[model samples]
Target: MRTGQQPSGHGFGSPGAAPRATNQNTVLGRAMGKVLAYIALTKPRVIELLLVATIPAMLMADRGNVDLWLVLSTLFGGWMGAASANSLNCVVDADIDKVMKRTAKRPLAREAVPTRNALVFGLALGLASFAWLWWRANLLAGVLVVITIAFYVLIYTMVLKRRTWQNVVWGGAAGCMPVLVGWAAVTGSLSWEPFVLFLIIFFWTPPHTWALAMRYKEDYKAAGVPMLPVIATEEHVTKQILFYSWAMVVTSLILVPAAGLVYAIVALLAGAWFLLLAHQLYRGVRGGAEVKPLKLFLQSNNYLSVLFVGLAIDSVLGLQTISEMFS
Candidate 1:
């Protein structure tokens, strides 16, 4: 029942007997607890997808000869930047999160992290991320990340989330920036390639997020967040999902000309599979079948994972195809 203590009284045994050991363990535990609370603010699972999108773009930017040091540094900066934005969001939305099942256990929502402390932590992380990226990568990469944090925290979280049903659609621009950041980190400039990747993610976000909103529609309603599923009928939401799914698929194939036959083939196959799943979700919702939005939500994860992984693989192995097309 004691905070950070073993049930059998591991750190609590006769305080004066093993004072040194007890003090050390207690300090270590508290330090770790603080670290974890901060990490939770960043929403690690969301950052994983961002990194997944980021790394492949770096590889493709460098044609598979990406600098490992650059990748590691960019990832670190990206994590800090993302953590900063998510933390600020939690701080601002603490009240809303407290009422929602999905976000109620967040550090700020649960009052585990003080509002003032969380605000400082988020701001510090944002500043550090910019400095780290600028020092380790390129100025463009650093600036792009700053823009990402601004869009997510100021534009999306503060301005749009509670105000519009189209929040996720517009707000997803922040999430799509990782590819730009990663590409700029390597190439020090923007190109059509990274833009295509950005479009792919932009189109993909609606279905990805709306499916989740559907699963937690009531929670969003309770929180007063105007997510699509909360404001629109199930059929309308699904139709929008299908629309974005197809748009995402189409944008994904634009890389074919640049990425060559291997990437082209993988994109086609993956896009087809993703579209099929979207259609299935639409049909299920339309027919009033006992379908769970989580079904589509889970599939969206796999769809993205497969597509991003395929991109990485093609970047390394698609040289022959690239050479053949260009030769």
Candidate 2:
């Protein structure tokens, strides 16, 4: 059986050690792992919320006769654009991410993805988004998506996030772009309707993000990020949350004249509940009760989802025609 030397009985080779098996299951598992890693780099959960804001804005803009192709194109472009921005942010924040528990497992932080690879991926996605929107939607929408990516990457992530407590407040301007892009894609022009939507999202950002910051205050502090909850007292943070919650509710009502009676009723009821939750958060923090900031955070997410759902339903029902009463 042996030509040059006798084979070792230990393994399928005549070596000192057994050769590892490259079975189909192992090979497939590795491939799937890499695929999931890339997906995680996109932050799909965050993108879900952004798309939620986008489609509803488009529905409101078209009053429901939306061109399916346009919606699909905008969504694809938005996903690519947001992925590019978020991936780059992970690269830039990788250092701090290593120190923070919540983000410690991100691709860049875990070294699952190389920084060079992430950078290239981000740039490619950005370019692809621009081309997709420009070709499928329109020039204005494409340009707006580019601006949104730049604003989040340049203005917020690079400039504001680490420097001031006002980061989320002022930087929220980028998040408001979806409404603008949606409106422009449909009408090719700006108007009071979309701008009011922009303000509602702008005002909502602080409270929504601040509630999350409260839960991660220690992580932000240790990471040297000056999130409001990290730099301010709990009472101060909750009071600010309350203020912004009320402002968001008030700003949402401004859309009443553009959306209609159904929107008005939904906004009123949802706003009342939202404000109540914010008040409870404030009171709990003031009294040092056992309530978690996450309670407010969860309710805030629901509030937005409900409000947007109302918009979609109202658009289908043609209730926007009622808005002309005030207009």
Candidate 3:
């Protein structure tokens, strides 16, 4: 309507207004970014690996006749427990995370979340995890969940991580607690079988973590963390990895008496494959050949995933039926 105005279509009131769209987009993007940052604080991949080991433990404990609702509830509590520990670990290592290239993008490291807020969030999840498991699973399961969170937050993150090269070796004990939690959730008791499952992961951690550390040696060195690869010769570190790899394979086999034939055969084959990969990495490093340590690292993930899947399949087949095949 103005003398020189041909159209008012581009004005603020118009549907096509650029400023309004941009402002909305900016607000939405920031909100989604914050949500993702909070999720990242929980270290989702590690939690996924924890669950892979957990469900199988439960399945075996209950002879594949587990109540689905119980399984779901136990999984939720276990996830919360793991997430709480990881979030708190992030808080404790925020300063070190900023120094490590591998961990620099984490929430506290990048200041996406306030340290106090992250700490509170972690504590809240821990309490919620305990309450949920106690109500839905059992007291023993809840107690185990809390113990793991405490160990991971106080012992591993605070005490061992920066102080020693054996950090992952021993710190990983906290990660193994989920198997026991899963077993207790189903049976309302702990047993040698679940303890054996716990040791498989306990031995598995060092090789898995150290392999990744080999690739990020500089990151740990710069962060002043004493990861084995950062402080030791490749020869020494590779030997250590092999030591743990052997322990992992042997511990996996130790489950055969409880799990029976199908799991035994799968564990034997999978353990062999895992050991092969582990040896290749060591031998390559030993002989001055180019090696991809992360190759072993990635396969280690696959190996554990497969091993647990085999356990689930064995449970489904019924341990007695599977054992009958060999008789």
Q: Which candidate is the best by lDDT?
A: 3
lDDT (10s digit) by residue, model 1, range 1-327:
778864553445654558788789999998998889888988888888777899999989888575789889999999999999888988889999999998989998888778999999999999999999999998999999999999999999999999999899999999999999999999899999999999998998899999999999999999999999988899999999999999999998877777856677788898898898888888998899977888788888888888887888888664755546677
Q: lDDT of all the models against the reference?
A: 0.88, 0.86, 0.91
* Selected candidate, larger TM-score, 2 vs 3: 3
Candidate that scores best on TM-score: 3
> How close is every model to the real structure, measured as TM-score?
0.91, 0.91, 0.94
Q: Rate residue 139 of model 3 by lDDT.
A: 100
Ranking by TM-score: 3, 2, 1
Candidate 2: tens digits of C-alpha lDDT, residues 1-327: 668876766755545443344466688888898787777888889887777688888888888476778888888888999999888888889899999999999988998888999999998999999898888878898899899999999999999999999999999888888888887887777788888888888998999999999999999999999999998999999999989999999999877777767777899999999999999889988888986888788778899888887887777677545547755
Clashing pairs in 1: none
Q: Which stretches of candidate 2 lie over 4 Å from their true place?
A: 1-21
Clashing pairs in 3: none
- Looking at model 2, which ten-residue stretch has the lowest summed lDDT? 13-22
Give me the displacement of residue 209 in model 3, in angstroms: 0.5
